[model samples]
Target: MKPICFLLLSTSAVFAADAPKPKPKPEFQYQTEGIQVSLPRADEPKVKAFGPETIKAAAKYLDDGAICWVREKTCVNCHTTGPYLSERPALARQLGMPLEEVLADFVKTVPAEVKPQKETEKDGIKYYGGSWTSIWRSIGLAEWDKHVTGKLSAHTERSLQEMLMRQSADGSFVSYGEVEIPHITTDFELTLQAARAVTAAPAWLSSLKDPELLARVEKMKAWLRNAPPKNDFDRILRLQLAYYMPELVPQPQRDAALSLLSSKQHADGGWCLRDMSALNDWHFKMSDTVVKLISGLPDAASPESDAYMTSFAIVLMRQNNVPVSDERIQRGLAWLKREQRVSGRWWMQSLYRGNYSYITYIATAQAMKALALCDELH
Candidate 1:
């Protein structure tokens, strides 16, 4: 009887040890009122990424921006807004909304969803910045297709074709809004934006198969080869164009660019920003009134490690096959995670404008992607 009682107690202890512990409630960045995310997944995949803390932080940051952006109608800048556009649907799904319905809500905000509100430029281009809109609209369509009908809308087709035509004989497109030239930071950032538009709209491109479009793409790729990158930012964008459009950048150039970027990684495990003069020259070539109005930011720049650029560099490195477990990546992720403000924004200066709202939005959006993508990697 004593032996049997001891054995029974041991069995009970084993069972209790196997019981699951309760998970901590998600610490969202804002009140749990308007937008929310599902409880963190407790599966193998989530663990394989970062632990729950990092993901919850990301959810909070994204949700905080969703309402503000839609109401202000400022989530429209393609360069600053593009990553957020691509990331929103995934966020919607995580919040347990019917993916299709939530995505439909987002589609309503895209430029092509309604008619262009402004008149044609002197160039007879109704969307002087229409090319950038095409990029954003197509990115929306791409994200939407993953969860919905997967069919390209009629407006999307027409919009894409028109956007494609907006490209110039020199294989460049007008960045249009806020920027007067391609050298917003990198001489080729705007050009890379043009390539990114086509690369992102896979469903549209796959369906159309226009030979003329193909030739134009080849021209764009070749143009990149001929056009040298102006700075560190340019160098990375050129590398990314290669990553997205392999046929565009030759193997040697890709290898060289990657080497250059890898070598530039700081000892602290993140990348730094370029000199002030690089951006200040063309960027601050602004109206006196507007310049005076911009406050809480600088007219010059600094050589410092920036979250936005570091995240960007991390993505570029990872896309080129650097593992998430790599020390450089781990440090980069650590740098980004530590830098997040309690309010959920990452600190970074402006290349185009000194508007803190725009600066924080763009940097935080890009950093979120870097962390999320790194987390995705096994």
Candidate 2:
């Protein structure tokens, strides 16, 4: 009887040992002030880990890169420098540094690389030959005032003057409009950039005696209202522009756009960038001009619920006055906190190799900006 019992027990132990073990939870880590912070997966209860110090850590890493990128790279596109510039003011404050001190030195180096398309088009001095010089320059000018001193730098002032001079009689700041479609790019990025610029000046647009700039501003508002956004990024930017110029977006349109964006939020409370082929007929056709742009070749990682898009979604909702305590906003914020890595960067893969990581860089910077902004309201 003892021999049989021992044999049975031994066999049971062997079977138990052979059984598979459960997998560990997924995690993301980011180092802050030399301390690494790890975040649990969305499925886990720990996804709600929100921390301001992480923003500080991420900003330090990004600021160092911004300075380096400007010094090493002559061009200043949205993917590289614009995102950094956009966030530096908040970052400067978080770091407890003077605003102008954070910006003045770098601001001096950009004007040369940011010249208008032509040195000689007075009536409609457009700036769109290379995208880096045109729309991004306008974006930088808007962000520059958040930290820089005195009036808009002379070059930015001249650029603004040109942009204002060229405003369409009907009022969309569309100096160039090749890119548009089912909802990722914009037809009036230049217009959005212009609205951003004048808003930073605080009543500068309203103060103008000409009334032409003011009227065009109204027309641009109407264009956004009547035209409706077919692209995702444009929709996002339009939401942002509405924040700066509330009168431009009617309350009903505002509520509808917000609902549209919220509806697109994934089950995990995050956002994903889908392939152009995945869109509806009208959208796919609208996005057809650049099929290669959306095809990520597997490794490029299209249609992933990435930190970049997710961060923008959260920030937009928050900026639009969605309460931080709201479950949707909280879940989205949790998603942002959940996806960041221990390296003080979020992993955002590219769709194309040549220009791929630039988007990643932009994503990282924007992620940092979004988190930092969230911290402000909290």
Candidate 3:
């Protein structure tokens, strides 16, 4: 009876000890709102022909160009062309071919989406800048196409040739707009990107053999050399063009343009596009310094620039071989994560412009690309 009682008491104690503890709460889980990216491993297929030096130089040039725009508080200018040029090498490797084929794919696929905006403010506002559609088409989706083959035809030559055509003796591109544009504005960044696309498609250019187009390209190159680096956007444009057309512009000018941009980098690592326009003009009492001082806007907690600008600046910096560990980079990332819409998208409200799909795509693609670039650099 004593042995039985002891066995029963021991069994009971063992059962109590074996009871499972409550499951610990999970610290991290799958992010439904984050971008779903399964990019191919970079180390699997070894890169050929291009050396680390080339990559480093290209990265530095791109970083300089991007910093220029950030310093100015605008993501236009060099940023317009930055993604195209910066993405070209990676896109080339992704397709396992030369950059020209990717450029051709861009030329073929992008124009279909460029139909004139028939309905405005219905689905979303679509703003028009000369060659803006062309710029967007040339970069975003076209870089991924691997099926493009063959060279430019005589008919295609006309379109490619028009890119170099000078609207005036001065280096600035002429406006199809009724405003009689005299200087390059932030709106023209898309056109700058489109022009870089033409330059990238070397095979197409070689096949076209249009003397007029070649001459015009040379003229634009010459014009950009002396082009004043007034704003961050202008400096970016000049530097981006110089990156591709090194033969046209001297290294000194390029260095100078880059230097101007580096000077503008803010202490927080983010850039501002602070518009100094009179508040009275827009019927507001706030001054430019006050409005430009914040990250996004009054309600936002980070910098004044929109998510689109912040993401783009990050992409540019990563492309130029800048470490993603920079304070500005981290702040920008934090801001991006916070800005994610419930639908897994991000929106950037420009101070003076309406919202649209273009900014949305730019912000999304740029944020994804920045994350990818940072991964590679690390």
Candidate 4:
């Protein structure tokens, strides 16, 4: 009887361990554009139909968020308004939407003169004031100039020059020292975005006659050429840089990078952020259990392929001249078209510490851009 009781007890323990955990309740929720948006979860409703109407809906969603951020926050944020301005102008051009308010707001952030500012310490690391803000503003304004205005504005050029003032002695722009994955986290990633900003504007680099500004540009280019990417995110940024500055990334290196990124695409034709870089690599302060809970991936080793990474991968591939007819590109496009949420936004769980998965804002923006590049927005 005793031996039989012991076996039963052990079997019960095993069953308990294998039981599925309940889905995590959202820490917070709010209404945006009259739709209730909870913190990003894996179970958001997928749209049943996707077409021109859906594209227009997405444009409205993006426009509302960007204009609201500009009016209310009145700040340049990497996850929300920053990515919106960088990507949405192109979509706005296609959809005939208004972006004047947001563009004006960005121009306002550029200062008349670049001056030294005090550094603030967070988590024992000192970050220069306005460094992060300047970098994002440069990228956003440059993209607005490239896609919407067709000529660089004086304000855009001023923003770029101010960004150079924040450049570190090593030629890389310093970040906020927080662990916000795929956005503001590393010096290398920030440097690449700065490079993108400089190159995106038509003939901006060639137009530079100031020896000091030209020297700074050469310094940044040298860092880009010599600085090795620390992770897959950095690698992706480097691949993007290759498009604008081919000499930075040699042909063999570019092919290798492309192959590495292509290999990570899941069977469902999407890319998982976790698969691209380990959670530990991002240095999340939370435990694995808590991170998994918030990400809604309790049983799996990693989160599923998400809209942000999928759209990002698609855009990167397209920039490298991968045609819409390619199998990988087609599959990725299908996944993006099928995954639109009912709110006309693409839901992506934040890789940062907070409950507000604002990364979804950028995800939605990137998704629209990906579709446009593939000629799916018509």
The lDDT leader among the candidates is 4
By TM-score: ranked, best first: 4, 2, 1, 3
Winner by lDDT between candidate 3 and candidate 1? 1
What TM-score would every model get versus the actual structure? Answer: 0.68, 0.69, 0.50, 0.85
lDDT of 2 by residue, 1-378 (tens): 555655666777878867997555433222324343343222323223445655555665566556555544545555556666656655555655423432444445344542333422333543334432444555565566545443555555544555555555456544332232211244455566667766675335656665655665677677756665645555556677778778777677678768877877777877765522243322322333345655534533535576777777777787898877778777777777777655455666543332224455566677766766667423
> In order, how many clashes per candidate?
1, 10, 11, 0
Of the two candidates 2 and 4, the one with more favorable TM-score, higher being better, is 4
Indicate the worst ten consecutive residues by lDDT in candidate 1.
39-48
Task: Write candidate 4's Cα lDDT for 49-110 as tens digits.
Answer: 88877887778777777766776578998887888878876676588845788878888878
Q: What's the lDDT for candidate 1?
A: 0.56
Model 4 spans with C-alpha error above 4 angstroms = 1-41, 116-127, 283-300
Over 1-378, each residue of candidate 1 has an lDDT whose tens digit, in order, gives: 555655666776878867996665445322334653232111212122343555565555555555444444444444333555565543443432322432444455444443433333543433344566655655555654544444666644554565566566666554433542223433366567666656655466566577977776667777776885555556656678877777777778778877777777776667765421244443323445333433233433335576766888787877778889988788888777666654445655544443233545556667766765676412
Looking at candidate 3, the ten consecutive residues that score lowest on lDDT are 35-44
lDDT (CA) for every model shown? 0.56, 0.56, 0.42, 0.78
Cα error, residue 86 of model 2, in Å, equals 1.7
TM-score of 1: 0.68
Residue 115 CA error for candidate 1 (Å)? 12
